[model samples]
Target: MVEQGKEQETKDFHPAPVWLDESYLEPLLRDLKKDPGLRITELEIKPATAKGDNYASVMTRVKILFLRSSAKIPEIEYYIVKTTYENDPFASDIFSKYQVSTTEMLMYEKVLPQLSALIEETRQPEKVFAATLHVDYEHDAIIFEDLAVSKHVLADRLIGFDLEHTRLALRKLAKMHAAAAVLNERKPGILTKFDHGIFNRYTKGFAPFFENLCDVAADFAATCPELGDHYARKLRELRKRVMEYSARVYDPQPDEFNTLVHGDFWVNNVMMRYGERKEPLDMILIDFQFCSWSSPAVDLHYFFNTSVQKPIRYEHQEELVQYYHTVLVETLKDLKFGGYTPTLRQFVLQLERGGFFAVTVALTCQAILTNDQTADADFNALMKDDERGRNFRKVLYHNKTLQENLKYMLPRFDRSGLLDVID
Candidate 1:
């Protein structure tokens, strides 16, 4: 009976793996043959590097060996295959409940194709980084091109981004936002069709998590009170404000420039391929999981809050925000919409409200960024016990730097009289 109980416990607690079964391979291969009109002989699959907030699915590259009627073509070539497990928490449910996978598939099938065609028509020769979708329904899988070899460029670390790359990224973001703005204006029906219930769920659910993270920050501060006191106060205040902010629905104010933001716009999501001698390549934005119609300033605020180092925030805060705004205006001009130029006053209000939201996200994400990725541990192991000491140290270090930066930026918002405006 004891042995039986132990076995039952094991079965009950077992977690699903990131990758799906290899059994799904044959159907995908069959689908590829049918879709691409390629005569496939053999296919090999292997794990590929997972990127961009991906915790639920493992991506793999598939090597396809095929024969072509034309003799000039290569016989054995590889293509990337992305597959996801059906039982993943992020996967779709039977009742059409909230699921990131389901939402993404919906966006790809219904939303993205129309956007892609429109973008192509408007801006010829300057292609957006849109992934092709292939659903293998029999195997419950999907496959697409590996963006790594293509125009995509992932800036893994933010330690070495020069001004040029930063400028390029901002400009690309602007163009994307501008295109989205134009689309919303031209086709309000398309914008209205998206289910924003997921966003509401996120904003609502995030507050308590942020409060818990603040408690972690406070605990970290207690370890080195003298060194971390200022940051601890800042984090506590930020947590309180974020909780209040999250409760309010994000209604786009009239005359505000709304756009379909690449809601997750950190350095990692942008993939770039450089020219000869490391010149700037095209910026390919990926991971549309959180893409939504919101104030474009949200993207600008989020990118700066997450990507730019803490030290740079104090020194170049104004310059960075101004750069984003300038690019936004230029991109708007390109789209022939001069009426919606985002003012400094409006940007400051966004900073206050959007900055609160960003700080919460940053605090939650800090644990992932600072932890030892290779450690054989669960969430409790990393976040609880003596391991918490090491994690606390990392958080304290970042908290100090981030708090110092916020101290400098926050007062600017107050002085500009935008604090009251945002709320």
Candidate 2:
């Protein structure tokens, strides 16, 4: 069910693009043969998400009522459309520089379909991806059937995912990682262009943004009575090494298992369908804008830190990792992949080697995901170097919930030496 709050917020969102009318969509529908000779009788468009829900792209929900070629009655269909940021130049530049738009287009147009075909060959009952309807590079838009049409809804990001959801997510993630490995094996060098994830040499543009966030996190840690100055000092020192550390953590290790990491895997990107008893029946992953070729550990750390509930995130991590490993290895074996699949111990070592990513995510994107609903999420507003940006940073980092989470997490990170520089 669409939350009442979300519905009202959607109504209040910015207007849709001027060109996204019936004339532009009708031809696209015809190409997909949604209905031969169908005519769009009515068209509607609305912002697909509220502010802060997404930043890299503008999502608009498009709905059309059409008359079928042979039937007299009209039928309604819905689509979720993704286009590049219209007016946000900073976001546009960053996305372009990172090839985010082209990469996602390729994922939908090429990679994901092949991955799904491979999964189907395995006869797995689970569906792991959303169906892409069209990719209009001319308009810079990728359209997909709104998963809401199939009773899928996003889990609440603020409350985080419980044990059931977390395990389900990890299982699916492992399958994806396994499938990715087999896909790459079958078609070598297919994923070379995806080497750049969120942090790479091209990340100089975001250095201020990340550095400021680190400082904000440090200040927040300093104020916590339990953490005091020690952890704060550690975080501040870590700030200086942000780029270096990100480079090391993001680099694929030669001896470890690597797959196409869903560079931004968290609650919001994974949609779920539920049964009558409210148990999750199935799930699908969305948002390939940041997909990268990296260690599965990167995806593991990013998801656990940002999406899983604190109890499970802090306590049952071992169980979750083992469960994911089991599914991953089984899937790889079932697919008859020729590459070496890491043993559980090797996987654990990979996770340990990639442990700094947990700190990286927790200190940066986790706070963004957990921030109060009212926080300004405009990419330029958050990235600017003025007083306004400083205040916005305060709003993002000083949230009570985020503060509480940091209090719980910081000590663990310190003990693991994640907040310290490794020589």
- State every prediction's TM-score relative to the real structure: 0.72, 0.95
Per-residue lDDT for 1-423 in model 1, tens only? 999976654443333234443444445554655543445566566555432234334456677666554444636655555434455332323113423455455565666666565555543325555576475444444556667656455665434245666777777776677666766677675663443432343334333344666666555555553435655655566555655653332345465666777666776667777888788777776656556667665566566656666545446667866777776666566567634666867876665655544554455544443233422223332333365535543443354444444445544543644333244
All models: lDDT? 0.54, 0.83
Write the residue-wise lDDT of candidate 2 on 327-403 in tens digits: 99888888998888888998898899888888888888887887665546667766788988888888887677678
Model 1 worst lDDT window (10 residues):
89-98
* Candidate 1 colliding pairs: 152-271, 152-272, 153-271, 153-272
Worst 10 residues of 2 by lDDT: 6-15
Off by over 4 Å in 1: 1-38, 50-53, 68-77, 83-98, 117-125, 135-142, 151-153, 158-160, 193-209, 222-234, 237-244, 247-251, 310-312, 337-341, 370-423
Question: lDDT: which candidate is best?
Answer: 2
- Give the RMSD in angstroms, all C-alphas superposed, for model 2: 2.8
Clashing residue pairs for model 2: none
